[model samples]
Target: EDKVVQSPLSLVVHEGDTVTLNCSYEVTNFRSLLWYKQEKKAPTFLFMLTSSGIEKKSGRLSSILDKKELFSILNITATQTGDSAIYLCAVRPGTASKLTFGTGTRLQVTL
Candidate 1:
């Protein structure tokens, strides 16, 4: 069975704290890994890591993928209260565009 799992499930941190979100997966013929930030509505794409783009970074957010281990990690530095959101990780199967998403990690940043 192909699945993605995120650890901790929830986290609490103060403003300006750095946090690491972990995602591990098991899938057949994995094509890529995607990261999303969820607030109220649908998730918003944060990063897409493939063989070509193994590492993606923007502002205080960055993510990296490991094809060999079938996992990825997202790092956020200098997080603020506005950064509080649910982080999602998904795997794209080689045969489909649909992504199988992890349960998600809820991050709460206190002011």
Candidate 2:
């Protein structure tokens, strides 16, 4: 069975703080790693990492994939209350278009 694990299931940080979220997986026919943020509504895509070493970035958020290690990490800098949300890590395995998601890491930024 495919398995994905995320660390620090919950976190509380002050505004302007930086955070790092982790995702590790073991599966067959590994394809890609994806990041998403969920609030009260549907989750929004953040990044899709397929190559190792190369980093994907957008504003204060960035993510990188390490195919050799079978894991990925998401970094958020200068976090704000608006950044507080459930961060999801998903992996696309094999030829299936479906994604397997982690339990997610909930972040709360306090002022």
Candidate 3:
């Protein structure tokens, strides 16, 4: 079975603080690692790391993948209260578009 696990199930941060979320996985035929931010109805895509592209960044958020280590990390700098959300990590195989999701890391940013 393919699985992804995220550390620090919940975190509290003040505005302007930086945070890092960790994700480790054990997967069969792994093809890529995906990160998403869940705040409302559905998760919003943040990054997708594969063999050809192992790192991705956007504004205060960035993520990197290590296939050999079977893990990935997400970094958020200068977080604001608006950044409070559940961060999810998922893995996808070459044969399917469906992803196996982690339990998610909940972040709370206070002003």
Q: For model 3, how does the per-residue alpha-carbon lDDT over 5-111 read when each residue is reduced to its tens digit?
A: 99989999999999999999988888889999999879999998986335688999999988888889999999999999999999998778889999999999998
Candidate that scores best on TM-score:
2
Residue pairs in candidate 2 whose N, alpha carbon or C atoms collide under 3 angstroms: none
Instruction: Compose the digit string of candidate 1's lDDT tens values, residues 1-111.
Output: 679999769999999999999999987788888999999888999999887436789999999987777778999999999889999999988988889999999999998
Scored by lDDT, model 2 comes in at: 0.94
Q: Which ranking of candidates, highest TM-score first? A: 2, 1, 3
Report backbone clashes per prediction: 0, 0, 0
RMSD of each: 1.4, 0.7, 1.4
Candidate 3 Cα outliers beyond 4 Å, as residue runs: none
Give stretches of model 1 more than 4 Å off. Answer: none
Error in Å for residue 111 of model 3: 1.1
Predicted structure 3: lDDT: 0.92
**Clash pairs (backbone) in predicted model 1:** none
Q: Candidate 2's residue-wise lDDT over 1-111, tens digit each?
A: 778899889999999999999999987899888999999999999999889999999999999999999999999999999999999999998788889999999999999
Error of 2 at 39 (Å): 0.4
lDDT of each: 0.91, 0.94, 0.92
* Cα lDDT, model 2, residue 92: 91
